[model samples]
Target: MAGAQRSEGVVTVVGSIHVDFFIRVPRLPRPGETIKGHGFAIKPGGKGANQAVGCGRLGLPTFMVGRLGRDFSELLLNNFRSNRVSTDYVYVDEETNTGVAFILLSDEGENMIAFDPGADYRLAPDDVKRAESVISRSSVLLTQLEVPLETVETALSLAKEKGVTTILNPAPARELPCSLLRRADVVTPNRVEAFMLTGVEVRDVKTAVEAGRKLLSMGAGSAVITMGGEGAVVVTSEDAYFVPAVRVKPVDTTGAGDAFNAGLAFGLAQGLPLVEAARLGCVIAALKVTKFGAQEGLPWREELEEYLRKGVLELTTPTRV
Candidate 1:
């Protein structure tokens, strides 16, 4: 395991940015069923933006690199500014509209989403190359699959070439090439995504371990399979263990995964061990679920530290599976 040696370098995030439309309902509607929503609000989102805000709020020097449409570009830019995330590499596309997500949130804290990727898909490898200086200087480069796969590949390849640690959060899961997996220092995927990636049903710790190992064999240096309330399974070349979730009553599940990924990246940038980083991720995700909305629920550095100081965040020994 690597020892802790905190770096002062920045954490660069290359992904999508979106304006989210949230609708709160009593329950998720069945297929072809009509339902009435009780609440509505608009917020800044996108896996990349959420993670960037999360990192910034946790006191990391964060930069966002992605494309936005002319329509909602200002909304997301202002959001980044307020959250202390730099928009140096954020571009505006005159042609396509910004990406938008329609989220149906249930009373049980579960959610269903549909999105039109819009200008998010227009993020090209050239845009990544334009941010080469920052990418090469980063201590940790975090990315997701919300944007173009080629752009993700380009950013990862460049970061790897510069010897930066790379974290890939494979959301909206899809089959990935081993070459892409090989460049990632860490790969984070929720249970559903783990199933999509490895064809293993990850219903329990045993299955999560199986799926995680498969990801390792496919070429990721480390695999963290997030199992929601069951915690996460961490697999590396040396060992595999399960980190128990921080028990909390959830108000909204949106962005919990992004919070986890952001926490993981922050820990790595601060030179913590993989297991410790994953533990931090669990704490962040737990805090995120206890509130409503995506970016709104993320805890600031002071809040997280205070939570830790209260001794409410207990980490049990990771059980080797």
Candidate 2:
């Protein structure tokens, strides 16, 4: 442990930033069918915002590289500021609408989502590169698929060139460019997204390993497939690890994966190895599910640590829910 250099802290998240509106209903409607929800409310959220909040809540010094419209820029800024995440790189646009996500959560805690990129589409390589300069100072950089592919490509390349560890949370399910995947130190994908990328139906541990291995072999340095209550499966070039999920009565699973990624990045920034980082991430995500909304569900550093210390944890990752 003493032979090499030690480091701490993370720099920034370069991706989609937006506001989230959550609607809770008794059951999800069939395709082309409409159903009424019991309640609805707006919350501060987005892959970038959720992850940024997760990092900040973990006591990491974090920043976000994103764009937003004037209508909601101040609100988003206030959310990050309140969480102590640096907002120096956040910019407001007059022409575009602020990014927003309309989410539907079932009483069982599953969710459906529709999002508008708004000013998130306006983010470009120049924006990410500018953030990269600042992010390069930290131990790790976290990126995601919510922003333009070109912008993400630029940030990942820049980070790799600087020998910085880069973590990519590939959400919304799409085929990622091999070049971009190659540049990533870690790729975190939910179960459905993993199937989209690798054609592996990740319903069990064996299948999860198969999917994760294929992804790592494709280009990613490592692959982490998040299987909701089944926990997370991690694949490195040389080995594979499975960190089981925690069992808390499910309230809302939205942003749970983002919370996990933030925890992993937070642990890695503090010099923890990949496996332990994933474990910590599992804890954070498990805790995230105990609440509703994306950002609202994310726990603060003290709260998470307090729960961690109690050690009354159980792995809930079954083959099926």
Q: Relative to the true structure, how large is the alpha-carbon lDDT of every model?
A: 0.91, 0.84
Give the per-residue lDDT digits (tens) of candidate 2, residues 155-247: 888878777789999987999877788999999998888998899998887788899888887899998888888688878877777778887
lDDT of 2 at 36: 88
* Stretches of model 2 off by over 4 angstroms after superposition: 1-7, 312-321
Backbone clashes in model 2 = 1
User: What's the lDDT of the predicted structure labeled candidate 2?
Assistant: 0.84
lDDT string, candidate 1, 1-321, tens digits = 221332355799999898999999999999999999978999999999999999999999999999999798888899999999999999999999999999999999999999999999999999999988877778899999999999999999998888889999999899999999999999999988998899999989999889999999999999999989778989999999899988889999999999999989989988888888999999999999999899988999999999889775566357888
Write down the worst ten-residue block by lDDT for model 2.
312-321
Stretches of model 1 off by over 4 angstroms after superposition: 1-9
**On a 0 to 1 TM-score scale, where does candidate 1 land against the true structure?**
0.97
TM-scores, one per candidate: 0.97, 0.94
